[model samples]
Structures are given as C-alpha cells and as structure tokens.
Target: MNRAFHRILIANRGEIAVRLIRAARELGLETIAVHADVDRAALHVLEADRAVSIGPAPAAESYLSIPAVLEAARASGAEAIHPGYGFLSENADFAQGVIDAGLVWIGPPPEAMRLLGDKLGAKALATKLGIPTVPGDDSERDRVDRSAEPKDQEKADAALIRKAKGVGFPLLLKAVAGGGGKGMRRVDRESELPEAIRSARREGHAAFGDSRLLVERFVSPAHHVEIQLFADAHGHVVHLGERECSIQRRHQKIVEESPSPTIDPAVREMMADAAVTLARAAGYRSAGTCEFLLDEQGRFYFLEVNTRLQVEHPVTEMVTGMDLARMQMVEATGKDLSRGQSVVEWRGHAIECRLYAEDPERGFLPSSGPVLMFKAPEGPGVRVDSGIMAGWHVGIHYDPILAKIIVHDHTRERAVARMQRALAETVVLGLTTNLGFLQVVVRHPEFVAGRTPIDFLDRHLRDWKAHESPPGAEVLALAAMAEWERLGMIGSGSGPSVVANGGSGADGDGSSPWRQLGPFRLGERRR
Candidate 1:
C-alpha cells in the first residue's frame, strides 16, 4: 500500500464501481460501495468488501446525494473516496466535500475540475495556450437567467440569437456543463434557434442544474476523437494515445477503439501535445479525457475536458497494458507518475462495444425487467466488464448500459472479427438489447473498411430494424436444444440424448431421431 489510504469508498454504481473495487483489492486496500435501494443486490454491491445503502431508487436522492456519500465514507472508516466516472464524479462541490471531510479525493483537485469542467472557461484557456478550439460564442454571451421574467428571458434569447448568427448557421447550442451529449442541440437553420435554445436550457437545468450554454459551429463529416490524459501533483503528465469515438447516436458514443484509424501520426502527436498543454495549464491530475472533433480537412478542435474517467477507458487499457483505476488509486497518494511519455507504449488494437438494455428497433428506448438469463463471452483477447446478473432487476433510474465488451488483437481487422465473435456468443434474455444492431454496425462494409464518420449510424442505419431477416438454421437448432435442456427432456451426458419408452435416456449408438432429423416438433395434446 502507498499508505495514503487503506480503505476507499466508491460513490457510484454499475460496472465502474465493480471495476474500482477490483482495482482497490489488487492494491491491498479495502473498499466500501454505496448503492441505491434498487441496487441493493447489484453486482457491484456483491463484489465490494462492504456495501451501504445510500437512499431510494432515484439518482437525485441517492447516487447524486453528496451528504449521503460522505456520511457513508465516514461511517465505513474509508480514508478516501473514488467517484467512478458518472454521478458525482465531475461534480466540483462533491470533490470539495470529500476533501473537507478529511479524506483523500481520488481525482483531480476541485479547483481544477471547476475551471476545466466549464466548457467556456476551458475554451478561453485553450485559446490563451494557442490550442485550436471550435469557433463559437462563450457562455457569457448567452447566459440565461432561470428566474428572469418573460421580458428578461426574451432579451436573453434575442442576445443569444444575435451572437449565434455571428457564428453562422449549422451550429450547436450546448450546455456549458454538458457531457455525454446531454443539454445539447443541433440548429440547422436560423428559425430553429429560439425553440432549440429553450429546450437546451431546460435540459441543462434538469440534467446538470446549470442552464448556462455556449454556441459553436457544427463541423459535419468529421470524426470524434479524444486523448486520454493522466497527471500527477509533481507536474508530470502523459497522454495515453487516442480513441476513435466517431460511432455515435444522438451525439453519444456507442463504440470506441484505440489507435484511431483516421489520425495521421503527425496529427496524433499534435493533439496529444495540445491535451497535455491544457492539462498542465489547469494543474489537472488524475484520469481525464480531452475530446476533439477531427474534420475532413484533418484539422482538429478542442471540444471539452471530462474531469473524470471516461466510459470508454477500457479500450486504452487494452492497448497500453495499463490499469487506469489502479493508477488513480496510487496517484491519489500524491505520488509521481510511474512512467513518463517515453516509457509509455501502445500495442495492437482494441475495440469496445457498450451493451445497453434498450430496443434499437424502437429508437433505443430503455428496457427494464428481470434479467432472467445473462451470459458473457470469454476467451483469448475478450474481456467483459459488467454489473448485472441473472435474476437481478434492471431499473429505469440509471443509464441503460448493461455492460461493455472489449477485445484486443494484433491488428484492427482481427480486433473487429473478435468483437463480432464475442457479440454473437454473448446472450442476455428477458429484455431487448442493442446486440443485433451492434452486430450490424461492426459488420458494415464501411466500418470494416475503416471509413467511419461521426454520422455513421445516420448514414447507414437511419431506418434499421431488428428481426428483418430470419435466423439461420444453426440459431434455430440452438434455440431448440436450449429449450430441450431447460425442460429436462435431454439427459446431461456426453452421449446422444433420447426419449425412449416415454422416458429420457441416452442412445448407445449415439444416433438419435432428433439428431437425424434437421428439425423436429413435439407432439401437442388437446388444450
């Protein structure tokens, strides 16, 4: 142990919390996991050394509650707290609370988070540092007063429109505190500005409790790439390559891979240098991501800084052979980095597909029910990070992501093939999943040729639907076999299973009637 902390509290749930608990155990440290009522029996809770109930099912009253988390930490005797990615991970006040409670906050300093967490401030800082930022109006030009009267609101809207016009049409109205595409909208024409502004602001307030917004020129036919950054208090920082997150829906990334296929070596170095420059300027430490938009012209612009670990971090880890969660734990002890940029290495290719409990045919609407069956694929070069299990409830109170399947290989082609194989082998019953849709995406000819763009889904799958084609013979046979097994109609042995004399048995010849017949049907009786 580094001695900074012996026991840590994870103030989040799902796969991330389970990830942290495993990392902490590897370092000879104890962990306390907090959960809402709906998550009392969650996989993360079962994995942690200790668990605490924070509040009700609602995130606002539970996972987002600062006091409850701190209280749990104090009660559990945890010397530190790790906010795993979402929830209060990026909340500056929560960081301050952890520090004020006399515990180590396993993340960047609250001050740094406050500065870089705001899109407008980070843009200004990037500009001062000569970093390329998207052309747009900062939040100061379009700040909305939530409590303002109708006239004042109208005045603010008018001013925002004027400033937006200056930036030109085909722009984005984004929340100053936005992340994960929340509180953001695309305005293709001048007429949509007012309604878009109102919706964006309302979403901003509802999602992040911050209605401040900024405008930016929307660059289409672009690829979304982000660089992973890690720093220490001793002023040592390193960039862990880049991730190609262009595969998205509604501006939210669904598929990510490391060693972006489209980035030039020179451009990659430049983007890494820019990310480190901004991190050093902000005095940032811990794990964070610097997002950028790579346009068709090969020019990249700084999008914003995520002040916490990203959902797609596993892709980086698979290529670099590094455990970022463990790094976070060690760095929280005020230690210098274990290695500098020179020692850092990248190998092979890594791809990650986020498995969500949603119906892709129905526009990815969240699906919730008991997970009657859950099976994860495993083998060489395959890794699954999940926080769900059979017989567990999937609620609508949180993100619908059930798990992440990450695959690594010596080449991008192999990686893609491995991911496709893994997805096909994996199974989750009782709720609709995007597994079929993901299969279609990873197998698309353009994706296979590495011609992915930000609008890949829109361009190829605009009217996609599930079950458009019939299952193959193998699939039908497997379903029948599973049903037979479930019904105990087949004996559990290596020999051929048969129904002899109206009793289940194994055939000596290993040639059963069911095996001889391509497809067999069970006799039905009168209802």
Candidate 2:
C-alpha cells in the first residue's frame, strides 16, 4: 500500500541536510530541520521550512539521540524522517524507533539494516550467494565479541593472533560495526597485531557502540570501487554504476568519480550484477552502496554494504541523471520505480572532491573557525553543494567537511581538467583547507594516468607540504586593508573593500579593485 506524506523531517545536519531539504521541496514536501544548540544558525536550519533544536553541541546528545530526534519530528508534525547518510542513518534501532513512532522511515527495513550493518553477517551472506569476498579468518569473531575478563581477553587475543598468522602478516583489523574509516587499522607485521586489535576495538566501540572486530587480508595496490544501488518495496533493484574512490586518507575517501577509469565493460557488468544480487538477497530498500576492492589482476572482492545515502552520491547523480534523495522518498511511500535496468543510462564522467576544514600538511587535523569568505566556482557542468557561507562558524562538534564540488564532462580527461579549474577558482578563506592539496593530487602524473590505488596518498604524498609561495607584500597589504575595512577599523571613505568574485563587497557600479588584481589565491594566505 502506497502512503503519501506531506511533510518530512531531516534528522541530520550540514550539507546533506540542506541537500535533502532541496530535494523534498522539489517534490512539494515540507521540510523540518533538527539541529544541536551550536547549529541554531547553521545553513541547513536557515534553509529549512521549520527548525527544531534537538539538544546540545555533542552529536550523541543531539543527532544520535533517538528520543530527541523523534520528539522533534513529532513536534514539527512531520510524517516521515530522513536520516541522510551519517549519524543514525545505518542504525537499525533508530529505524525501528521511527516505525514505532508511527512515522515513515525513509530507509531500509530494520531487519535488512541489521543484516548488512554487521560486516561479518554481510560477508556470510555474500559468500552464501556465491559473491566473492576477501579471504580472512571469520572463525574468531564470536570469541572477540564475548571476551570481557582479563583472562578471556588474553585468550581471545591469542586466538586472533594465531588466526591472523594464517591470513598473512599484512592484514586489516576492522570493527565489525564500523564506517567512515573508524575502527580500522592496517597491520603489516606480527609485532603490530596485539595493539592494533586493542586500538580497533576501543575506537570501534566508541564510534559504533560495538567492540567486536574482524581481520581481513589487506589487498594493496587495489582500487576502491563502489556500486550505487537503489531498491524498492516492490522487489525491484538496480545499480546506477561504479564510483572509483581510491584517493583516500586514513581509510576515508576524499575524491570519487563515476565510470571508474580503469574498469572495463565486462567487469562493470559483473560488479553491478553482484551488487544487485546482494541487495535483493538482503531485502534492501532505498539508497545503498556496495563497496569492493579490485586488484590489478581484475579480481574483485566484496567489502561491505553502506545502508544509506553516500556522501559521493552526487557523482553518480551527475553521470546517471538520477535524483537519489527523491528516489528514496518515493520508495519509502511504497511506490515502484518507473524505470528498469534496461532503460537506465549512464552518460559521460563525473568527479567529486570533498572540501574539508583540515590542514593536509598537518596530518589532516580538523581546522575550525569562522568562514570569512566563501566563493564557489561557476561554469558549465560544475555543481557545488555547500552548507556554509561567509560568517558561518566551523566547529569541532561535527565532521569538518564544508562542501562537495562535483563536475561532469564528456570524458574522464575533460572532467579531470574541469575539476582542476573548479578547484583553482574556489575560494575559502579564514581557515586551513585541503583545496591546494586536492589541486596537487589531480595534477599528479599518476592520478592523471588513472593509476590511483588504495595507498595512493601513503605511497606518493606521505611527506606532502604546501609548496606555494606566500602572498607577496603588496597582496598582504591589500588583504590587511580589506580586513581593516571589514572590522570597521578604517572609515568607509578611506578605501574600497576587496571581495572575491560574486561577493557583495563591491560597489553597485560593478567595478572593484579585485577585478584589476587578476587571479590570486586568497585562501593560500595562512591566518
């Protein structure tokens, strides 16, 4: 039975919340935005039709609190809740709670979420369905989960070490219930195994509330590919295409592109088929992603399923011309998909780069402060999905990602060039960012040749530094003058203010000093 809803509540914040709000508005559905105390003035809150304060600054008390989010939904008169990508997006208990509250949950069923959310269970199902998975020791997962006392923990560790020896020296210690690279560690030698297990368990427990761990053979020099999947309640499932996400730091993807540059037609078909098959077997619904690792020999192994919308979904949308957020809402209403696999088409190439408040030179540590200026690039095939504007505060309470820049073109080479141009034109002042580092990665010869592997950063840019020369004395002086004018330290008649392109600082006459200065990297000037 199809159920229609007039309003939906977005249970997350940041760029994804803003994205969902836009998608819902296009469907003529009212949107309610929930936020923490610090996010009262956030972009998503400002854009939403109605806003509710869930709790304080910490995610656990706000976005992750089922009671707070559900109360907000009820108070806002929302008929459905959309958990976009992170927070409680993958939590089965949260999904169940939404259903118990008599509100529509725009995601997979709780049973399916539980089945696929556990890496061990997902792998077991894939193996049963004849889908290839990475070779690892699955025998000791239960022991690790049950071990609590000192003696039992020691035995479990010994058993894990013995099993790991069979898996080989180089393997990954991963949390059974983990995502976003949390609860993951790479062990290259036996001496690093014990501490790695303890560390992974501690981190995993802190992140996902589960301390169980799994060991898998580390596949190096491999490409991280994921298939975008959509399923409905009517037993229909289709895969959009594959996205290559090999460029990562700390196991979290930073750059993604559709129509993987190195994947051949045959392998694409095979992977797509496997992903659809897995989705069907799990009775999955809404937007999900099946991740895999493809080696040089062309052999691929299933990794896990992300049971929610992905951060890099824009690349898939750009290539496939599909609105995934809208599709999820439609599916939640018990509606069948209008298109099938045969009619679905993928055109051209699309690339996405995440803009984060982090310093790449400083081990990618989170950077936070006020956004003084923000100018997204504009041109053909360029799309900027942002959640911050000038005067917005970047805080440490949440993920540091501020925006995503997606570009599309007829070919991968052209898309790469367009991304480079977009990055160059992007302006984010008042904080350290990875914009310059992203520029270097895209321009690297190996990246240009599409030779990116899982360890691309560790192998090529382990000692990366900001090579750009600081702003010249004249540019610095101009910047100082602009700051003084902004702070009202100088009188309005003293001088004209300098502003980036598309900003309002220029006079109404459309002529400004910035126009004559030509191009300069305003963000490159360290604060």
Top candidate (TM-score): 2
- Where does the lowest 10-residue lDDT sum fall in candidate 1? 518-527
- How does model 2 fare in lDDT? 0.87
lDDT of every predicted structure (CA atoms): 0.85, 0.87
| Total clashing pairs for each candidate | 0, 0
Query: What's the lDDT of the predicted structure labeled candidate 1?
Result: 0.85
- lDDT tens digits, residue span 235-270, model 1: 899999999999998778899999999999999999
Query: For candidate 2, what's the RMSD?
Result: 3.5
Q: Write the per-residue lDDT of candidate 2 for residues 1-527, one digit (tens) a residue.
A: 78899999999999999999999999999999999999998889988999999999999999999999999998889999999988999999999999999999999999999999999999999999999999997764555453223346777778889999999968998888899999999999999998998888788877788877788999988999999999898888999999999999989999999989888789989999999999999999999999999999999999999999999999999999999999999889999886689878999999999999998988999999877667688889999998887668899989899999999999999999999999887877567788889988999999888888988999999999876555654774576566546545457543221232233453333343433444444346643
Pick the lDDT winner.
2
Stretches > 4 Å off in candidate 1? 1-3, 139-151, 468-527
TM-score of 2: 0.92
